[model samples]
Target: MVLRAVAVSRTQEDGGRSELLRGTGVGPVGGLAASGLVLGMQCALLGVGAGTGLLALEGARPADALAYGAAVCGTCALLAAATMLLAQLTTDATGARGAGLAALGLLYAGHGVWAAERWSRAGAWSPFALRGAIDPGGADDWCPLLVAGAALLVLLAVAAAAARGRDLGVGLIRFGLRHRRPLRAGGPVTLALRLSRMQLLAWAVATAAVAGVLTAMGENMVELARRGAVEGGVLGSLLGGSDPGAGLLDYIGVLAGALACAQAVVLVGRFAAEERSELVEAERGTGSGSARLLSAWCLVSLLAAALTLGAAALVSGLVGAALLDTTAGDALRLVAGQWPSAAASAGVTALLGGLWPQARWLAWAPLLGRVA
Candidate 1:
């Protein structure tokens, strides 16, 4: 979503019709479609890479890998369509990221809730169940893929309609309440915080939801661990030796840290958007020196990323302590242990963005490779 917004800003810099025509030919919606094409191609390449890696294993077949790659690409395109639709619906870049991620959280949480309750053939109905259809199961079921395609079409249609209703650069609908009075005082740091607050809030809520669900299923996790699922893996050793519950909590903390880094990538993308739109230079012209503005941008984005991760850990720890009979101190401390890694990720992104803004996208490569 952040990328989509940046593409929009880049395609229509300064909201000028000449640029829009020269860059996108038609309008903002066309620019959005072009971005979707690029993203879809990237997703296809990633899927092919993953499938090729799988095929390199001893028992893997080339045909199966190719099929899975195709399926994965289709799934990625559908998901990208949904994200682009959400990006088009928002009035600003930050709002696009916040809304797109929040929607993803809800979709994933809804799938978890549905999976937890419906033990039967619920895969046919869950919108976020693309993993099942693409993985080792290889069941040749195309219903879920068809559903995703339908959803993609719907999202594309709606986004186009919304775009048609709005002006060239503005959104179809605005978010938030308007203040009557215009008297306010804020520096660069404050403005950065304000821009990133919604993104932080959305991530916090998503993390809490995930943690709550994990806590609720503590007994099942314990049973799985006792069944030797948690005793034979490197992850288990890294998490803890024997106590599966604590190990699980730590594992989640590690994942949360990774997610925090992903959020940092989104922040860097936002910085790119601001630069494309000349917002950074305007701020400098308004008396915020270039060095100070850069400092505040990095500091505030890093702070927002760090604080959101901490708050999520704290919330999840409290919930685990309450529902899973775990000590709050242990849970909080274990989760906090992962914060430094996330902080380092944010720092790396900030450094890349500050020193070599043109290559800021490179900062995502390490973290994304780790994830893949």
Candidate 2:
């Protein structure tokens, strides 16, 4: 939903490409406030909808549902604010959204790892730990929620102050600033790689981190399965259908592959960004064909997907072999299957971007749906 900021940035004259907000008689801070209000309202509506569902499902008191709703609202508003800040730190809206979603993925994965390892007490400071802190089943703790709200406010204040001092449509942190030359024309594929190198590297690191954590988590899950089996609990069968350790490891491996494919989708958005910025037309004017540009981008996304997913699977398999006595074949096969899926995602996004740049954001719909 915060992608709206980027989408709107193109239409508003004072917000377009490089125009200052004050050109519309609104200071940058005021502009932030205005957009922030819109994002907050959206978040609030989402919270109300989500809270209503929670109320229906859990039969919780209205007060508890309202509390959960506030948590959801505040967290979402914070994410939108952070995404706005990211847009100021990236060369384009796509990079900002990609990085923002990646950050959210990392936070969710960290919480997952914490939960999988059963680190209930010591991992209280983990990102999104408020889920447990706000749980009605977990003592109805509210202190952490208040602390998180305070931290979010402070961060928003800092972001607004920083935005006041920055130029429009320029990142505070950028890549290759010292290099002044335009991309060499002979190698469009090379240019694509250069453009997306940083984002790919960031995703690679994040994938590896999650792969390692999930791989390690398999052993803990196996242990819990054994405990549940002894206690005759249903969670044992649910967690580990038959072969506890190996099954959980394979599940984690496939999950890592999915993450890798999602990373590839992030690279696809760079193509969309290029189209939005008219970089595609500029390349065309320099004799680069549209088909070639898009094919090159698709190829880059595929290669990145392969490398990151392959590495993640290898890492997971190696760790599982050592820790959980699992074989590598299943992990390798699972990732092999995802190669085509990643390619498809890349092709879909690249084609949409080439044909209708406005709808390029729709590429994320399927992935978000799956995650949901």
Q: Which candidate number would show the highest lDDT if scored against the true structure?
A: 2
Clashing pairs in 1: none
RMSD of 2: 3.7
Expressed as tens digits, the lDDT of each residue in 238-350 for candidate 1 is 43446666776776676666677777766655665677677888787779876677667667657766676677677667877766556777567666566666667667777
Q: List TM-scores for all candidates, in order.
A: 0.85, 0.83
The prediction achieving the highest TM-score against the true structure is: 1
Runs off by more than 4 Å, candidate 2 = 1-21, 86-102, 109-123, 174-176, 179-182, 226-238, 354-356
Evaluated against the true structure, the overall lDDT of model 2 is 0.68
Number of clashing pairs, model 2?
0
Q: What's model 1's TM-score?
A: 0.85
Looking at model 2, report the run of 10 residues with the lowest lDDT sum.
9-18
For model 1, the local distance difference test gives 0.65
lDDT of each: 0.65, 0.68
* Clashing pairs for predicted structure model 2, backbone only: none
Sliding window of 10 residues with minimal summed lDDT for model 1: 9-18
TM-score of 2: 0.83
